[model samples]
Target chain A: MMYLFFLTALFMGWSLGANDAANVFGAAVGTKMISFRSAALVSSVCVIAGAVLLGEGSSEGLNSLGNIDSLLAASIVLLSAGITVMLMTRLGLPVSTSQAIIGAIVASNLFFHEPLHLESVSKIALTWVYSPLLAFLISFALYAAIRWIINHMRIHLLMIDHYNRILLFIAGAAGAFALGANNIANVVGLFIFPFEKAQVTLLPFFPRLSTQLFFLGSLAIGAGIITFSKRVMITMGNSLFELYAVSAFVVVISSALVLLLFSSQSLSQFLQHRGLPSFPLIPVSQSQSSVGAVLGIAAARKGWHSIRRGLLLKIAAGWVATPLGAALITYVSFSFLSLFIDL
Target chain B: MKLFTGKNKMLMSNIDSFLQLIGDSSTYFHKALESYLSSDENTFTEYLKKVSVIEHEADELLKKVKHDLYAFMLIPDTRADVFRFINDLDNIIDSSKQLLVQLSIQRPLFSPSLSDGIISLVTVNCESMKALIETASVFFRQPSLVENRALAVIRCEEKVDAIGERIEREIFSLESSYSLSEKMQLSQFNRQICSLSDLAEDIARDLIIFALKRMV
Candidate 1:
């Protein structure tokens, strides 16, 4: 019976992988610099490593949002978020799974009369707004610096081409690792409370049951990447303004840096140790960060004229609509499920 | 396998071969024009055939360049720009072939008075083409020098334009026994040859734009 509830979390993990993997290596695959098979292999390994090793940081904030003691309610929330993401994806809209999950959790809390963690919720909300803005600023500065260095170095065009290909691979790997570290929380963070003491070692070599669950979630993400990310990668690679190899490199790296900044617990602690303000470890949207990076580069190059305003407006609308739609869906679905099941 | 491994060297070699073929085609055009002026029918016919063959070879090289460009992952930054540049350069070869063919079909006689201006126009246009080729080659080898080399092409084009206009004026003022239709044919020939230089200048402008993009 517990296994049945776990499937919803796996479904959510799969949806996150299908949609967010493109944010990591879309341009490289789209430009035909890296084959789709090679990208999938690298992304799978890195995402798993990241989730197993460093996925805990942002979950602290996520867990604080609302703790649902009931497994049935948690499953409903996950299912509602997954279904909302799937619906939005079919509608050709770019919605963040992280945002959808948060909204679903909030709605579930309200429905059950659970105490809302207002302070943590507000902190997570602030990071969501800051994440994209920071990504844009970092990308703008990084691209300008790269452009300066290219002009100063007087590198041959062929040599620059070779260098960009290598750099793109490195950046793609970094982005994948960052995606796993930051977004694994969105996939499995909500269930951690109920399963906190439930430990089952699947393999003799493994540590505990929680690690196993995280591994399973990461595997689902890997499956999503292998089976479903190709079309989204192509759209991201070609539909956006014609990204030169250099610009593509800058965008990927800057977005990865933003994710790492928000998700790295060690970095946050180090800042606190130094008497500096620590960054909130929130599970921000990788899709938003990637789009922000592109917009930053575009704005740096040619201001508003270079950006696709209509496409961006549609994305903005999707961002606002995703969470609200997921919350409403979760409310309705949970009420319907309560009628049939003893919650 | 060889094409995949050393793509930089292969693209450079292909570009070199394409430039060599274009130069050969331009030379054949000059020889054909000179033979026509000297009234050597057999030599003119030989040069026309040579120009046609060289143009065909150049076209083949262009096709290979395009095929390799699409097949292998070469320079991603400038690949599209380079592809468009090659297409533009291909036009010069086509114009050279068309000019030779026109001379062969019409067989327009040039008065001795107009001969010097006609040869000068062709000479200037060929020189412009040669400079443009050099600039394009330099663009691939050393992008920093591309802007400087492109300036030479611009200067050569100015000379071609000036000489072409003078030749047109000379054709209209001819006091020899020529019919109105013959004069019109001569004027048309002058325009066609001059059009080659204009094409070169247009290509040079594109090269400059490409170079500026690299600089940025």
Candidate 2:
């Protein structure tokens, strides 16, 4: 009964993986530049590597924001976020796991009478704006460079196809790695206190207990990719945007760079030690970053007129609604849970 | 990177050979037309047979390239445009086959004055095809250079059109001994020969637009 609570986190991880895996490999699979099988395999393997290795920094940031010390409390927080994602997606509303988890964490902190870390909250909110903007800028610069190179090279059409396939695979792998590293925190970071005590030893081998939980979380994400991501990936390829192989390559690379910017401790440390401003280690949404990267590409290819202004406004609205929805749901759920069990 | 597998390399070589076959077919078309004008039946038949054989080989190569492109290897993004122009080259080969076969079937006796004009028209068509093939070849390797090569084709097409008109007028205004039906037959043959250059010119114009995409 006690351990059953972690299953919610596992569910959260699964959903996160299923949805975000598309963000990484969707364009490649959709464009027929990469096969679904190759995309899934590379995403799974690299996701696990990222979760186990680079997942630490962002999880620490989530803990600073708020960590529920009790298993029941942690489960409630994660489940609330999971339910919010599922409900919003079902309603065809734009949703983000990062916003949901942050909202749930803040709600849980309020429920437990813990002081909210405003600094961490502010840092996270800032990244919500910065992540996509960063992705857009990165995509713009990368697309320009790639376009120039392709024109100047004058390679045979077959040779260009060969290079696109090769580059798309490598970019997909990097995107997957960044996905796992950046997003594992959203899956299990709230359960840090419980995970710290309850060791994860049986599954993916790792040195630290959090690393093991990340391994477990990443497996669920990998499972999500294999089981449910095929349609999502193909749909992304076919109708969502119809990205060319080079465009897909650029999107994935930009998203990965944005995620890495938020998650890499060494990069942050290097920036801080040199007195340069560093992005806070926060789990920004990969899906949002991808949308931003796409917008950047559209803007670069055409101009601002090319960007769908309606979609931009809708996503901005979702940013506000997701967190408030998760917080409201978590607060109400806490009330319901308290009636049945002591907090 | 090794760049291409053995299978892909073979496919690429197949595409190259197909373009070469079109060029070869153009040469044969010229030879066949020249021999027919000279009334050398034996040599005309020989060149016609060569064109037919090259047409068959080029078709086989086209089928393989089409298969490979559709099978998800070559027919990706901008490459689709490249293949479309490449596909147009096959039409050139087919035109050569049609013209040679028609000549072989009719074997009309060309007037002595008309033979020179007909030969001049065929020469222009040949030059136009040469430039068309060059435009396609450059499109694959150096698309930036395709504009000049394609323009060369258009220029040849202009020469072909002028010669074709002069020949048609000459046939119609020939000596009173020439029968009306005989003049009509020669005019029809002249028009068919000019049509090949027209096809080349159309492909070259489209290639310019496609090659512009490749540049920026």
Candidate 3:
């Protein structure tokens, strides 16, 4: 019976892998620089590695958003978030799973009469707002630096092409790792609170069962990538203004950096040890960061006129709709589940 | 396995093969013209067959170059420029083939005065194509030498144009011993031969742009 509740978490993991994996390798696959088969393989391996090793830091942040004492409530929240994400993905909008799960958690908190941690919620909210803008600024600066290097170095065009492909593969792998690290919390963090007393040892040398569960969730995400990410990959590759291979490389690297900064615990601790303020470890929207980086490159290349404003507006609309849509779905689903199940 | 092989080497090989085929086509065009002027019907047929074969080979290489460019990631900055440049070079080969075919079919009688000028135009155009091939090859190896070769192509094109125009003027200024239709045919043939040089000049100009892009 307890295993039934875990299915929702796995479903959420699958949804994330199906959708968010596109953020990691979409540009590479879309531009035909990397084959979809290779992209999926690398993404799955890197994402699982990231989730198993570095997932705990941002999971701590997500855990503080709301503490749901009931297992049923946790299952419903994940299900609602997963459903909302799946819906938005079907509509071809790259909505963030981080936003969806947070919205679902906040709604479940309200539904269960749990007290909301306004400070943690607001901090996470602020990062959501700041991440895309940071990604844009970083991408703009990075592109300018790269262009300067290319011009001054006078590298042969063929060499630049070869270098771009190599760099893109590295960046895509890093981005996949960052996505798995930061966003695994959205899939399995809620279940951690309910499973606190049910720890099982997977390996004597490894940590507790909670980490094992996170690995399982991440594996489900990888399964999702293998099974259902091809269409989204194609859409991402061709839909936006034709991305040059260099611009695609810049966007992936910059967004990966932004995701890494928000989720790297060691970086935060290092800053804190130096008596400097550290960035809050928060789960940020990889989709927003990727789009923001693309926009930065576009603006740098042709100014605002070159940007596809309609596509931007549609994505922005999906961003606004995601959290609200997930919140409402969580509220309604929880009410329905309460009639047949103990809360 | 394919990725480990340097794409530069592959791109260069495809380009070299394409240039070689274009050279063969130009050779056949020159031979066909020589056969026509010397009234060797059997040799003209043989040269026409050779031009046709070389043109087909050039077309095949062009298709391979295009497929490889799309399939493998070449230099991002100049991939499109290289594609357009190769396309223009292909046009030069295509013009040579078309010129040979017209010469074989029309068999326009060239007056002795126009024969020398026509031969000179073909020779100069062939030199222009040869210069372009050198410029392109140098562009891949030593970009610094491309400018001098490209200038030579321009110079050859100008000579071809001068000879072509003079021949046309000579044909029109001929007495009624040449029919109106015959003079028009001669003038058309002269323009067709000049067009080969014109196409080479266009490609040379594009090569200069590609070279400048690389230097910057």
Best by TM-score: 2
* Candidate 3 clashing pairs, residues 3+ apart or interchain: A30-A237
lDDT accuracy of residue B157 in candidate 2? 91
Candidates in order: C-alpha RMSD to true structure: 3.9, 2.6, 4.7
Better of 1 and 3 by DockQ: 1
Off by over 4 Å in 2: A31-34, A90-94, A197-205, A239-243, A303-305, B1-8, B142-148, B212-216
lDDT at A159 for candidate 2?
72
Chain B superposition TM-score per model: 0.94, 0.93, 0.95
Q: A170, model 3: CA deviation in Å?
A: 1.5
**TM-score per candidate, chains pooled:** 0.85, 0.92, 0.82
For candidate 3, chain B by itself scores a TM value of 0.95
**Stretches of model 1 off by over 4 angstroms after superposition:** A86-94, A111-113, A150-161, A241-245, A304-324, B1-9, B20-56, B73-81, B98-109, B134-159, B175-188, B205-216
Per-residue error (Å), model 3, residue A90? 5.5
Per-candidate DockQ values are 0.28, 0.36, 0.25
Of 2 and 3, the candidate ahead on TM-score is 2
- Give the worst 10-residue stretch by lDDT in candidate 3 chain A: A197-206
What does candidate 2's lDDT look like per residue over B117-171, in tens digits? 9888888888888888888888877878989999899999989889999999999
For all candidates, the clash counts are 0, 1, 1
Write the residue-wise lDDT of candidate 3 on B1-216 in tens digits: 234568666776778889888887887788789889989999989988888887788788888888778777555456678889888888887777787788878889997778888888888877887888898887765566678899999999889878888998899999889999999998998998998888888888888877776652
Compose the digit string of candidate 3's lDDT tens values, residues A1-343. 6678888888888878887787668766776776889899999999888888888888888888877766778888887887897898889886888888889888988888889899998888878767887888898888878877765565555666677777878888999899888888887788777777455353455566668777988998998998898788778756531436678778888988998888889999999999997878878888889888978887776677887888678667766888899999999998887888777
Each model's lDDT comes to: 0.81, 0.83, 0.81
Instruction: For model 2, name the residue pairs that clash.
Output: A30-A237
